[model samples]
Target: MDLVLLAIVVGIGVGIVVGALGAGGGILAVPVLVFLLGMPVHSATASSLVIVLITALASLPHHARRKNVDWRNGLVFAGVSVVGAVVGSRLSALVPSQLLLTLFGVMLVAVAVAMLRRALRTRAEERAEAEQALAEDSAAHDPAAHDPAGQEDAEPVATHDDPVLDQPGPDMVDGADGIRHHHGEPEVPLSPAAPAAPRLPLVIGAATLTGFLTGFFGVGGGFIVVPMLVIALGLAMRRASGTSLLVMVVATAASLLARVGTEVQVDWVTTLIFAAGSAVGGMLGGPLSAKARPSTLTLAFSALLGGVAAVTLVQTLLG
Candidate 1:
């Protein structure tokens, strides 16, 4: 097959993977080009960068339209990621690209396993909490028990809807006599925790490292980016996905700029054609993402992560 034709085909595949899984382009792009098409890793990495940049660009306007970019947070992480990518890209020229892929493959597998563990743990916790809530509700509803002074207090931790209280709620316990039985009545004060913006620094650190790997190895960071955002940064799946695409858009652009004068090869024409396909595909993706159920998304994401892990494990051992 012609190299440009091959690249365009791969680009469409990468775009669909990105649209569906939110990250997997470079991993798919590199291995296919290397083993199947016999492209050298170095050239493949450069070519993968082209594919990544184009797909990322294609995905960006959709995310921007959805208002998930969080530019301030994106800027901080993107700045760090750009630096890391430049360093990683420069290093890519010195070290063997094959070695980078092998290392990256391991990293990808490790992240997938970690996320699977976290997802299981989170689901368990949510279930346990729900069960406890049900038990509590049953106890509180008992007709024989006295709820004097509404002592059977049902306190809900403040959410986005209500103002957070500075001081604890009145610390008086309910009395059996339907009133404060005595002056020394003890009340369990509700603990108030501060709500933080989801875009935290530690999460950004993960994003930066993912970008470095993506830019350095020519893989999409979606596997790492989406899970980290959902599990660590507490972003919803759609938001994490949208945010990941934006970050990719920034990181890929920066790396491409660095590679412009380098010895790395890029088929810009092929890359553009692939991106043209992705633009239409991605327009359809954003709305689908918004409509998908969270549970369905999580399960689907878990399956995708499992696949990536299996691919990485096979590739790493083979390499």
Candidate 2:
């Protein structure tokens, strides 16, 4: 196959993956450019940076429209990571390429393990929640269940004179946020609590590490960002993915700027073609991501990470 065509195909696949999961997709571009298109690693890295930035920007709109992008948090994370990106860029030359690739492989494996464990924990939590809800529902309905007043907590009987009373009088309904609501009582709107004070430090630390990886590898650190947002920030998977892309756009752009006037070489024509394909794929993937089940997405993302890690490990060891 023609090299340009091959690159475009690879780019499309990477873009789709990125759009869906928010990270690790663009990392494949470097290997494809280096191994398949036969570009040197440095050139491939530079070109991949361009593609990563373009692809992230392309898919961002879809996420924005869906209200999945957390702009405040994303910007904060990106802003902090920029400092780390600059530092990582400066240190990139000091590291050997083989060692860098090996480290990248290790990082991918670690992320995969973390994702798998999270998925299992989430599943167990959901199961426990379901059982608890069922028990509550049963107790609410059963006449044998007594309240603290020692009277059976039976459903209230409606009087013909008060037609509204015939309808199920307000009993306690379990809410998703672990709050229970009494039907007859005025519902207290439990407003969203202020952002947790403790999360700022966690965000800063994660973003700094992510920025370092982004600059050192010439790849977006979505893999790191997505999980951090989900695990630490309490964002759902789709929101985390969207926010990760937003951060990637910032970090990758900064990294690319750092390379300006450097000795890096790029094949602009191939890069453009690949980027075009990525843009198209990204558009398609965003909607699909929002529709996907979180557990399924997490498992699939973990598998992909594991696959990439294995490939990188073998290549690094063999070469």
Candidate 3:
């Protein structure tokens, strides 16, 4: 296939993936530029940052309108991450490409494993909830299910809709992508509660690490940021995803600028064409993501990570 054609095709896919999955999208870009487009790894990484920045910007509005973004928190994370990105970009010049590839392969495997584990856990939790609901229904219908004292009036068991249980569950709609609605399930509304004290440190640490990776590898840092938001900060998955794009815009811009005239060199013609395709595809991915089941998406992402890891490992080993 013609190289320009290939870049355009791959760019669209990368943008959609970013819109759908956030951070991992940049991983695909680096490999495509290196192996398919015949660019050196360093140059590919720098170019990938530029593409990632544009894709994030393109996808931002979709999530923003859905109220998925936490601008204050996003800015905090982005601020710290930008510092790390600058440091990482400078260090990238000294690292051997082979070593970088090996490290990236390892990182991919780790992400795949983490994704698969989370998927399995989510499935198990859903199953448990179903079983509990069934048991409650059975108990409610049983003649002897009343209070042992046989009081004339008894308190009813609280249901999923109870205020106490109103906390977001795994199956809760993360409609940040603007597509997957379940029988009119409402979007998980954002809480204005302050993050816990412990969460502040965790967010700082994770954001810093995410930024460093973005600069070093020319990735958008969404994969790491999204999960951290979900796990550490208690943000809904959709909110985490939307907020991730906001953070990426800043971090990637910093990383790209750091590489100017230093690490990233490209044929502006091919780069521009690829970026345009990516921007268009990014706009479409938000709606598609809303339709996808979280479990299904997680499993698919896991598989993709594993496949990429295998390919990277093999290439790095052979080279």
Candidate 4:
């Protein structure tokens, strides 16, 4: 009974991470099951898949309600990733348990370092934007700063050659229904000029890699998917996070199905209890994440991953 309670508590924590960040469910779950619940590595990895699948599915509705999901793109990415997931699951059976744990530790460290670098970059960008805003404000006050040529009385010339000015205004967006909508307004038919297409090849390559990682490590692959959606598909961080959940649901399901015939045994009782707790946590985290700053959350999560990785490495190598 006590162990079941502990599992619930741990699952909630893992689910909160997955729900809020759109990743980390399996990364955290595998270690917790092995070290805390005394489950074997193989069993833990398989069980982690269940926890991730449940959490992602539970959290997805909240993001969808906020219009954060891009259904068409997410489905395409998931479909391509299924092949990679099957291949990776087959390869995972060949690797030894100790080696897999060690590799998982190394991957955690790499992800932590990458996240730290991204946080630092975001901070620098924010600082640069603030400085630029200050400079613009100062120039507005001192007309001479912006009008060095001293042509204040001359009529300003409108230049159509500057493509930046021709772009859609901030509030305009192409909705899923093939209409353009102004912020908080009714949708209208889109203009004949359409947005540029996303990079299909890059997206496919990233999805395949994400699937391989999910199957091999029992991770949700949201860390990779979120970044791919943001950089390759031109989604904002919040939208990318929501969209990544949709991808994770498919990726985890594919990986789990591939393991069906394997000899590895899963403790269904513990797995279901953990999943139940995660489902509740997912409900809370989705709303909380929508209110929090992405940079702050990313830095905190990276630190947590670093600590977990250190502990896992020490225990695996020395004990």
Model 2: lDDT to the true structure: 0.74
Clashing pairs in model 3, backbone N/Cα/C closer than 3 A: 23-222, 23-223, 179-290, 179-291, 180-290, 180-291
lDDT of each: 0.60, 0.74, 0.76, 0.81
Give the count of colliding residue pairs in each prediction: 2, 2, 6, 0
Q: Compared to the true structure, candidate 2 yields what TM-score?
A: 0.79
Worst 10 residues of 3 by lDDT: 157-166
On residues 135-252, what C-alpha lDDT tens digit does candidate 1 reach at each position? 7778777864455766657454221100111122122224554332112332223333523345466666776787678668876677677666655554445556777777777777
Report the lDDT tens digits of candidate 2 across residue range 240-263: 788999999999888777777667
Write down the TM-score of every candidate: 0.69, 0.79, 0.82, 0.84
Model 4: which ten-residue window has the lowest total lDDT?
157-166
Q: Which one wins by lDDT: 3 or 4?
A: 4
Tens digits of per-residue lDDT for model 4, 1-319 = 9999998998888888888988788889988999999988888888988889999999999999987788888888898889888888878877899999999999999999988887777666556656766886887789586775766665432222111112333224666765554444433455566446677899889999999988988889898898788767766677678889999999999999999899878899999999998888888888877776666778887898999899899989888
Query: Where does candidate 4 stray beyond 4 Å?
Result: 134-195
User: TM-score winner among the candidates?
Assistant: 4
> lDDT-based ranking, best first?
4, 3, 2, 1
Model 2, runs deviating above 4 Å: 130-195
Count backbone clashes in candidate 1.
Answer: 2
Ranking by TM-score: 4, 3, 2, 1
Query: lDDT winner among the candidates?
Result: 4
CA shift of 229, model 4, Å: 0.9
